[model samples]
Target: MSRKLLIDIHTHLYLPRYAQLLRARSQIPRITTLNGEERLVILAGEAATGRPVGPSYWDRDAKLRFMDTHGIAISIVSPANPWLDFLPPAPALQTCEALNSDLEEYCATSPEVELGGRRRKRLYGMGYLPVVPGQEVGGVCAAVEALGKLPHIKGVILGTQGLGKGLDDPALLPMWESIAKAGLVVFLHPHYGMPPEVWGAQENGHVLPLALGFPFETTTAVARLILTGILDKLPALKLLLAHSGGALPVLSSRLASCIAHDPVAASRLAHDARYYLGRMWYDAVAYGPEELAFVVPTRGTDRLLCGTDHPFFPPLKGEEMWMSVTENLDAVENAPGWSEGEKEGVRGGNAVELFGL
Candidate 1:
């Protein structure tokens, strides 16, 4: 029997140079040493209990080993959240250009993989952009143009916010047009969850913010884009939503109903809010088969791709395979009503076609 192709499209890694930049900062999203171990403190209230940072984040060898252990053949890595969102326009553009170059080199230099009958680079990348507030459209568009020239960059990862005002901001139209013209996918990820108070004063670690807040953040961003006609204006834009499209698949019907009741919103969209769901892609990182199965009906099997949010949700203890990886793998393999070929596509074939990998 032939080996099943497994490509992870949602992995994350910070290049060493980028890590050093974080280390130099003293605020949230900085990397600091706590009791002799480097810890990455990104989200709000994480400074006291930041996650450990090590080779798994930046070491090429460590990434390869993790991939091998999890049966992932190829990984499309991007910088984790808070990407260029903090920097001023000038510094943001400079850092975006340099980091994108490093990202291209990082993937371009990785060892090749033998799959089917061909040898291809084992790694690929999702580039970053200077999407910070006050960043001129020219700079953002320029980054998009430069990314088009990078052979290994298949897409660009983005946070929910766009130029400070959220994705619906009109200022991002030029950047959107440039990305679509360049034929690159947008991997929409959530960084800033809801306000800190929404989680209350309880110390629940990252459970509420990550599990609940992240999904809703993505849900709100995409909903605004749809209602505001971003999709209608740029039908060619290829967007891949992370975390199984957050809460989109489940809430799309609700969104459509709400739009139906609101005359203003009803006239705003070109189609039913749910219809746009078909126009976008989603990753199978829901951590459960049912949630994975739920998204397929919204867009069918073709739009679903497998992903592992590697190096973030690593095992709680030593050397064990990550549940985050295994759960997603099982979800794709066992999603109800899917044929063997469909499962294979979600496993890797879909990504191969989507990003031209």
Candidate 2:
């Protein structure tokens, strides 16, 4: 593949239907007009200081335009954070079905691009699930089966919280099995950060939650999944961790040591803790080349797919190109040990092979 065939695997959008669902809510995860501008209030204490949202959050045309500007040929889009987890089991399942249908339609009807002397869709998607607690595994499996039938929906975006418990919950084993059986990748993302008191009593904007909380949440969740031997049982499961495995690569050694010291924990896994990092996939969204380089040893070059968490970290100064996107692109380009072919793999080739794009 040419270097120009850049594929972004972590882009996001909220469908109009999902947006309307949020707008109808009277709680934290709702949209409301503040001082004549619409803001999305998803996190705790963000009701008054929610961030502004607009067409970029839902418009397909806007997404294509952004892709064109950034030289992205294809994007694997998913619904953004705080997904249907807060709703009741019935509403959550219903909402997820509707949103999944909308996402399929969104990708199926997108404009085509010329690639490899043929026309193909410029967009694909990762669907959502009603993985709430008390929701039947049968229902979730049925949803997974439905996603498998959609040509454009290649994977499912899941949060760290599984069935209202964390990923380590044995209750989610059937959920993992069904997803694996459908051959859909699980793009594990983080939404609930650490407890608020850790950041101190004073207001700190979103800096602490975004920078520290999100990644830590991912790290802990994934660690629990690994330590509890979920990956050991579900060997066929394909997990693509957001934010470059969220410090897992950096902390795997320490975790291994701790597990080694504890006989009960060490006996649970078939292999060492670090070995599972290679088994999982990661996106190059860590912003620094050094971070990407550090991750490659544990998560090999082929497992590292390029991504941009777009529509979240847009240019603050109204610049045309997003720094968040470029920073990740640059990281993959300049990652110390990567050769040209390896860089190409990280940029788009890996995603093409992983998602069968």
Candidate 3:
């Protein structure tokens, strides 16, 4: 039997150059040495207990090893969160270029990477663009153009906060146009999920913030994009939303209903909110059969792509295969009423088409 191509659209890595930059910084989003090992601390809230650092983050061998062990055939990796968002324009530009180049090289040089037993181009990348403060639409456009030129960069991963303001910023329209012109997929990912106040005084843990906040942030951003008519303006722009397009597939109808009820919002877009929802791709990072089932009907199997947020939500035991990956794979296979061929599409086939893999 032929092995089905299993592509992970959501794996993350800290490119060596990018990780170096992070290590040099002294603030949140910086790497610090602890007990003879490096740990990456992104959010200020999580600074006290930073994520464990190892080769799984910046080393290509480690990434390939995990992919091999987990049966992942191809991984379109992007930088981890808070990517180049804190740097100044000049530094950010240099950093973005270096990181993009490094990411491309990492993939291009890995075509011979042996997965399980055979050689394959198992590692690919989504490039980073420096759209921090002071980087205007023109700079962003240039960055987007430069990013698209990278041979292995299938797309550009963007945070919810684009150029300080949200993605619905009018200032980003030109950048959007440029990206559309390049025919690059924009992976809309969430970073700063929500305000601390939203978690309430009783909540001191990250469970509420990461679980509820991240998806909420993505849902709000995509909803705003649809309602603000960005989707209408850039109808051709390909958007891939992380975390199963957040809670969008389930909440699309309610968002559409709100748009219909609100006079201003209703007139802003040419189509209902759910119509634009169909125009995008969603990652199968919801982590369950039921969640995948809910998302499948809403986005359709073709638009659903598999992903494992590797190295971050990896298995706690060092030797164990990542539960995050297995669960997502199982979810795709077990999605209600889906045939093997249909499940295969979500598992990797859709990502192959989405990223031109």
Q: Count the backbone clashes (under 3 Å) in each candidate.
A: 0, 0, 0
RMSD each, Å: 1.3, 1.1, 2.4
Please give, for residues 295-346, the per-residue lDDT of candidate 1 as tens digits: 9877998999888898898886685889888888888777899999888888
Q: Give the range of the ten consecutive residues with the poorest summed lDDT in model 1.
A: 1-10
Give the local distance difference test score of model 3: 0.84
lDDT of 1 at 216: 90
Would you list the rank order by TM-score, best first?
2, 1, 3
Better candidate by lDDT, 2 or 3: 2
lDDT of each: 0.90, 0.90, 0.84
166-241: candidate 3 lDDT, tens digit per residue: 8888888898899998889988898888888877788476788789889999999988778668877887899999
- TM-score versus the correct structure, for each prediction: 0.97, 0.98, 0.95
Q: Per-residue lDDT tens digits of candidate 2, residues 194-291?
A: 89899998988999998989999999999999988888888889999999888788888898889888999999988988888889999999999999
Task: Give the residue spans of candidate 2 off by over 4 A.
Answer: none
Question: Residue 93: error of model 3 in Å?
Answer: 1.1
